[model samples]
Structures are given as C-alpha cells and as structure tokens.
Target: MQQYDVYIERQKRKRQRLIRRLVLFSLITLIVLGSMAGYHLQQRAVYAEKVEEYEQLEDTLADLEHEELLLEEEIELLQNEDYILDIARTNYFFSKEGELIFKIPDESPSY
Candidate 1:
C-alpha cells in the first residue's frame, strides 16, 4: 500500500508539471504574435507616408514640365530677327549706324 501511494503522488506531480509548461509556452506565443502585429502596423504607416510623398513629387515634376514647355516657346520667339532687334534696342540701348549719338553722364561709380 505504501508503494502504491508513492506512485500515485509521482504521477500527479508529472501531470502538474506538464500543465505548467504548456501554459508558459502559450503565454510566450501570444507575446510574440502581438509584437509582430504591432511591427507590421508601424511599417504600414511608414509606407503610406512614403506613398504620399511620391505623389507630391510627381506633381512637382509635372509642373516643371509645363514650365519647360513655356520656356521652349519663348526661346523659339527670341530666335526671330525682329525679336532679337527689340531686345538689343531696349536692353542694350542699341541704334542703327549713322544715327545721332548722345552720351549721358552718370554720377554712380562704374564697376
């Protein structure tokens, strides 16, 4: 009878140990899964911000392309002889040869 009671006590202890080990394993798995979910959520937020930034860059590129077209048109106009003459007359104060020459004196220092 004494041996049987000792055997029963040992079996009960084994069962309790197994239950504790399973509970600990379950707790660890839950923690790992929760942390993974949080990490994925953070990555999604960062990815969304990058997408917005990319869209803004695309818009800026489109605006620059429009400005480039306008500049190209202006360049074509400047290639005309009359447009070149107009710029030289107003900006450089140019006149035809054999015309009257007037010299205006300036008090400011010339560099």
Candidate 2:
C-alpha cells in the first residue's frame, strides 16, 4: 500500500508540471501575436498619413496649374505692342518727346 501511494504522488507531480508548461507556452504565443498585431497597426497608420500628405500635395499642384494658366494668358496680352506701350505709359509715367501725356491716377494693385 505504501508503494502504491508513492506511485500516485509521482504521477500527480508529473501532471502538474505538464500543465505548467502548457500554460507558459500559451502565454508566450499570446504575447507574440499581440506584438505582431501592434506592429501592423502602426504600419497602417503611417501609410494613411503618407496618403494624406500626398493628397494635399496633389491639391496644391492643381492650384498652381490654374495660376500658371492665368499668368500665361496675361503674358500673351502683354506681348501686344499697344498693350506694352499702355502699361509703360500708365505705370512708369513715360511719354515720347513732345507728346501730351495725361496724368490720371487709378486705385489698383501694382504688379
């Protein structure tokens, strides 16, 4: 009876050790999975921020293109000979020799 009692005690110890090992492995697996999930979430956040930045840049480029078109049209107008002489006379107050120049001031923004 004593020998049987000793055998049962040893079996109980073995089962407890096995249970402890399984619990430790389960905890480690959970930690690794959690870490991987956190890393992926961080990556997604950074990607989203980059996409937003690129979208803002795209909008700025579109506005610049519109401004460029207006400037190009203005340049075409300025290429005309009469328009050039008018701008020179009005803005610079320049006149040809012996020509009657009109002095009329206007409220406008300068170039």
Candidate 3:
C-alpha cells in the first residue's frame, strides 16, 4: 500500500511539471510572435515611405528629361545660321546691306 501511494504521488508531480513546462513554452512563443509582428509592421511603414520617395524621384527625373530635350532643341536652333540671323534681326534690329528699317510707333496712348 505504501509503495502504491508513493507511485501515485510521483505521477501527479510529473503531470504538474509537464503542465508547467507547456505553459512556459506557450508564453515564450506568444512573446516571440508578438515581437515579430511589431517588427514586420515597422518594416512595412519604412517600405511605404521609401516607395513614395522613389515615386517622387522618378517624377523629378521625368521632368528634368523633358526640360533637357527642350534645351537641346533650343541649342540646335541657335546653331543654325538662318535661325541666328533671324534672332539677330528681331532682337538687335540688324539689317542687311542696303536694307531699310522703319520704326513704327505704337498707337496706344502712353501712361
């Protein structure tokens, strides 16, 4: 009877230990999962910010590319002899040999 009682007591203690271990393991797993979830959320926010910045940079690059093309066209026009002559005549009021230039006054009343 004594030996049987001792065996029963040992089995109960073993069951208690196993339950405690399982509870501890579950708690640790929950903590680890929670930490990982937080980290993932933080990374997502950073990624979203980076994506927005990348989009802005891409838009700026596109605008700069368009401006560059316009400048290139202007440069080509400036390099042409006929375009230069036209620009000089209009801006500087230059005339060819024996050519006449008339200064027409504006009809609007001056303030």
Against the true structure, what is each candidate's TM-score? Answer: 0.69, 0.70, 0.78
List the candidates ranked by TM-score, beginning with the highest.
3, 2, 1
Superposed Cα deviation of residue 32, candidate 2 (Å): 0.8
Query: Where does the lowest 10-residue lDDT sum fall in candidate 1?
Result: 95-104
Predicted candidate 2 versus true structure: per-residue lDDT over 1-111, tens digit per residue: 999999999999999999999999999999999999999999999999999999999999999999999999999998898899888988898897798877767879688
CA RMSD per model (angstroms): 4.4, 5.0, 2.3
lDDT of 2: 0.95
Model 1 alpha-carbon drift over 4 Å, by segment:
84-111
lDDT (Cα, 0-100) at 99 in candidate 1: 64
Q: List the residue pairs that clash in candidate 1.
A: none
Which structure is stronger by lDDT: 1 or 2? Answer: 2
The lDDT values for all models are 0.94, 0.95, 0.98
Q: Give per-residue CA lDDT, model 1, range 1-111, as digits (tens).
A: 999999999999999999999999999999999999999999999999999999999999999999999999999998899999888877788887776647689989899
Clash count per candidate: 0, 0, 0
How good is model 1 by TM-score?
A: 0.69
Candidate number with the higher TM-score (1 or 2): 2
